[model samples]
Structures are given as structure tokens and as C-alpha cells.
Target: MSFLTLLDYASVLVFAASGAMVASRAQLDIVGFAFIACLTAVGGGTVRDLLLDRHPVFWVADPMPIVLAALMAVLVFFTAHLVESRLRWVVWLDSFALAIAVPAGTGAAIELGHGPVIVVLMGMATGAFGGLMRDVVCNEVPLVLKQGEPYVSCAMIGAMSAITLVWMELPLNIALLVCAAVTWASRASALLWGWSLPVYKSRPPRQ
Candidate 1:
């Protein structure tokens, strides 16, 4: 009903679908799909809530998120074979999830009156942790740790965008909209235009 609640549900659905896609890639069963989907749907939010000391956590407060995740997993489990590339589906779905989640997190921290740095960190955690957990549990390389990707940068920039807008006295909902826009655009650019950060290169000393 509320903007923050909308963001949370949107992120959960998209993230759950992404997690199910990963399960499809791993050839996991329906139960595995539900497990991974629920994990990925709420993992970041759970971490954020625990760190912020939100009572009962988000999912515990309302179990609908978990039920929604299971439903999404079921849908994906039956439909995954139709996708040309499950990996691409996972990445793209995750991009959308990250976009929504970063703002959701930033808004939550801001609502709690946390400072800007904490806001940004919570946003990044919300955008990244779910996918990281999904990948680790699926025995895949975590997307957050992938070389040359700007995932974390996108999250930080998204959160900062919200902070800037709020500092200028813009409405929180409007700021969150901007946050999601920037987050998705940044991630989409990386996927579509090959935008990336430079990775470390090692060289022999005194060569």
C-alpha cells in the first residue's frame, strides 16, 4: 500500500525470480527453487533489518513475502525451460531487483534517521546480499564479487542520489524513484554497453 512496501514487494518478486532462474541453471528441483527464491527474496532485507534492529524483521512481520517467493519459484520452475538463457534472465531480473532494493533500503535507513553513510551501506547490502547468498548457495560465483562489475558502485550511487534529493528537501518517494531509475540505468548500461570498472592487474616486482 505504501511506497516503501511497494518497493519491498517489487524487489522481492524480481529477486525471487532471479533466484529461481539460478536454480533452473543448477537443475534443481521445485523445493530447491522455493528455498533459493525465498532466501534471495529476503536475504538482504533480513540482514538490513537485523543490523538496524527492526523488530520481528520484515519477512517475519508479514509472511506474505515468503509465500510470494514460493509462488514465484513455482512459476519459474515450470517456465524456466522456455527462456533462451537462464543466466541472462537471472542477471537482468537481478538488475531490476537491485534497483528497487537499493532505494527500499535507503528509505528504511532514512526513516530510522540514520546518517548518510549508513543509508548508503544499507542500500548496497539490500541490493547485493541476496544475490550473493543465492550464488553461494547455488555454488556459483557471487555476482557482487565478479571481476570488473560495477554492481556495488551502482548501489552506492543510487543511494547517494536519494540522499542528495532528500537533502534538497525533495519528497522521499520522489527521491526513491530517482534512486531506482539511476540504479537500473547504471546496471543496464553495464549489461548493454559493457560499462565496467577496471580490475586489478598484478606485475612482478622490479621486472
Candidate 2:
């Protein structure tokens, strides 16, 4: 199997785990767990593929992601209670997924001969939109939409860094590793230190 293919599967697994955690917290049934897990696993990649005009969609082309996601959901359903902090665990898992997915998306775009701008956008979308869909369905604020969160920014930086390194003739595998490391480290730091971007301050209207 290709490295990118492996990355894709890993991304699906982590994202699915995050979704399952959310479903567990919501006290959902097995079916609910499966639904959310599938959604989170493929939601962002689906969007990226559609936007790039890739036919048959990814999960349609390869059913392993679906199966893996469902399996993860079932596993979490039985084991969730062991996790004392479900919400926190979900966030970190999603971050790991983001780290993998961003480079996966960017590499796919680069292989497709897409330009830098499209590559960066696709990378960010792939990393973030899954979590966005997950939170929306779970009735919680999406991390990308949360005030001051550096979620999307982290993806962007990692994607751009990967692209730049590739442009510099670095090996694709090396670039991907650096990208994932940068993305994960940035996100982990944010979570550990409560770091966030500056929010807009609206001024009061003058009388």
C-alpha cells in the first residue's frame, strides 16, 4: 500500500474515534454511534473530493474507511465509560486526525497538479471540516467556529509548510512527516496552554 493510502486510513480511524466519543457522551445508541462515526470519517474528504471534481467519492471507491469507522464506533460504544474525560479525549483525537488529514489532502492535491492555493485550501478543509460536521451534528460548537481557536490556522500552517518543503525538493514522505508533526504540536500546545488567536473586538457605536 502507498504511504498516502496508509495516512488516509489512519486519519479515518482517529476521526472515527473522535466521533464515537462524542456519540458516547451523548448517550446515543449503536446506530447513532455508527452514523456519527461514518460522518466524521468521510465528511471532510467528501467535501474535498467534490470540490476537486473527483468522481465516485473516496469512501465509495474504497469501503474500508466505512468499515473501519463502524468498527471504531462499536468499540467506543462498549469502552467509552473507561474514559473519564470523554470531551477532552475527543478534542485530542480530532487534533491527531487533523494532523494526518491535512497532509493527506495536500499531497493528493499536489499529485493532481493543483496549484499552491488550491492545495492549501484542500488541506485545511480536509483537516477541519470533519470535526466541523461532527460538532454540528453533536450540537456543540465546531472547533473551527469556536472563538479564538487556532484549529484552521494550524491546518493552514502545516499545509503551507508541507507545500513549501515539497517545492524545495524535499521527499514527499519527509514533507508529510514534518507537516503532521507541526500540525499536531501546534494543536497540542494550544490544548495544553489554552492558547488561542486574537478575536475581533467590536467597538461600541458613537452616540
Candidate 3:
């Protein structure tokens, strides 16, 4: 398989893992696990494909990603008891997924003949929207909107980095790796150190 195809499958697995972890925390059953897993695995890519007008969608064109996500959910269901910290595991797993998916999305857009702006937007959408959908479905605050987290920002930076490197004629493999590294490092640092952008504070209405 090509590198992009490999990244797609890897992102599906990691995102599915994170989704299943969340389902476990919510005391969801097997079907719930499967639903969340599939959603988180394909939500962002689905959106990106639709926006880009890709026919049949991606997971629809190839059901392997869905099957893989369901299988991952089953594995997580069976092994959740062995994990002492599902929440932490979900965050870390999501960070890695973001790293992979960002480049996957950006690369897709680039291949579609889009310029850098769309490439960056598609990359961020692919990296962050799936998790956003996952959290919304799970009834948790989406990480992208959460305070003291740099989720979307990390995705944007990674996407831009990849696009910039490619624009500079760097090897695609090298660009992908460097972008993934930037995303992973930024997200991991945020999770480990509570790093975040400043919040906008609005004044209260006059009493």
C-alpha cells in the first residue's frame, strides 16, 4: 500500500481506539462502542470528501475502514478492564490520530489540485472534526472547544507545515513525517503541561 493508504488505516485504528475508550467510560454496550468507533474513525474524512466532492465517499468506497473500526471497538470492549486510565489513553491516542489524519487530509486536497488554503482547511477538518463529532455524540465537551487544549491549533500547524514543505519541493514522505511530528509534539505538550491559548473574557452586562 502507498503511504497515504497506510496513514488512512492507521488513523482509523487510532481514532477507533479513542472512541471505544470513550464508550467504555460511558458504560456503553457493544453496539454503542461500534457506533462511536465508526463515527470517530470516519467522521472527519467523510466531511472532507463531501466538501471535495469525492464520489461514493471514502469508507463507502472501501468498507475496510468501517470493519477495522468495529473490530477495534470489540477489542477495546474486551480489554477495557485491563486499562486503569481510559481518559488519558484516549487523549494520547487522539493526538497520534490527529498527527496522521492531518497529513492524510492535506495530501488528499493537494492531490485534488487545491491550493494551499483549501489544503490547510481540509487537513484541519480531517484531523479535528472526527473527534469533535465523537465528543458531541458522547455528550462530552469537544476537545477542540475545550479550554487549555490546543487540538485544532495543532492540526492547523501540522497541515500548514506539510503544505509549506511540499510547496518547497521537499519529499512527500519527509514532509508528512515532519508535520506529524509537529502535531504530536504540540498536542502531547499541551496534554502534559496544560498549555493553551489565551481565553477571551467578555465583561458582564451592567447590573
- Which candidate has the top score in TM-score? 1
Question: Which candidate achieves the best lDDT against the true structure?
Answer: 1
Query: What digit string (tens of lDDT, one per residue) describes model 3 on residues 1-207?
Result: 778878889999999999999999999999999999999999999999999998889888889999999999999999999999888898889999999999899888988999999999999999998999999989988878987578899999999999999999998888988888998988889999999898876776843
Residue pairs with colliding backbones in model 1 are none
Q: What is the C-alpha lDDT of each candidate?
A: 0.95, 0.92, 0.92
Model 1, C-alpha of 49: deviation from truth (Å): 0.1
Candidate 3 regions off by >4 Å? 204-207
Q: Pairing residues by index, what is the TM-score of model 3?
A: 0.96
Return model 2's CA RMSD, one decimal. Answer: 1.4
Candidate 3 local lDDT, residue 120: 93
* Backbone clash count for every predicted candidate, in the order shown: 0, 0, 0
**Candidate 1 TM-score over all chains jointly:** 0.97
Candidate 1's residue-wise lDDT over 1-207, tens digit each? 789988999999999999999999898999999999999999999999999999899889899999999999999999888889778888899999999999999999999999999999999999999999999999999999889988999999999999999999999999999999999999999989999999987876945
TM-score of each model, in listed order: 0.97, 0.96, 0.96
Worst 10 residues of 2 by lDDT: 198-207
User: Candidates 1 and 2: which is better by lDDT?
Assistant: 1
**Candidate 1's C-alpha lDDT?**
0.95
Assess the local accuracy of residue 185 in candidate 3 as a C-alpha lDDT between 0 and 100. Answer: 89
Q: Which is better, 1 or 3, measured by lDDT? A: 1
Question: Is candidate 2 or 3 superior in TM-score?
Answer: 2
- List the candidate 1 regions with Cα displacement exceeding 4 Å: 204-207
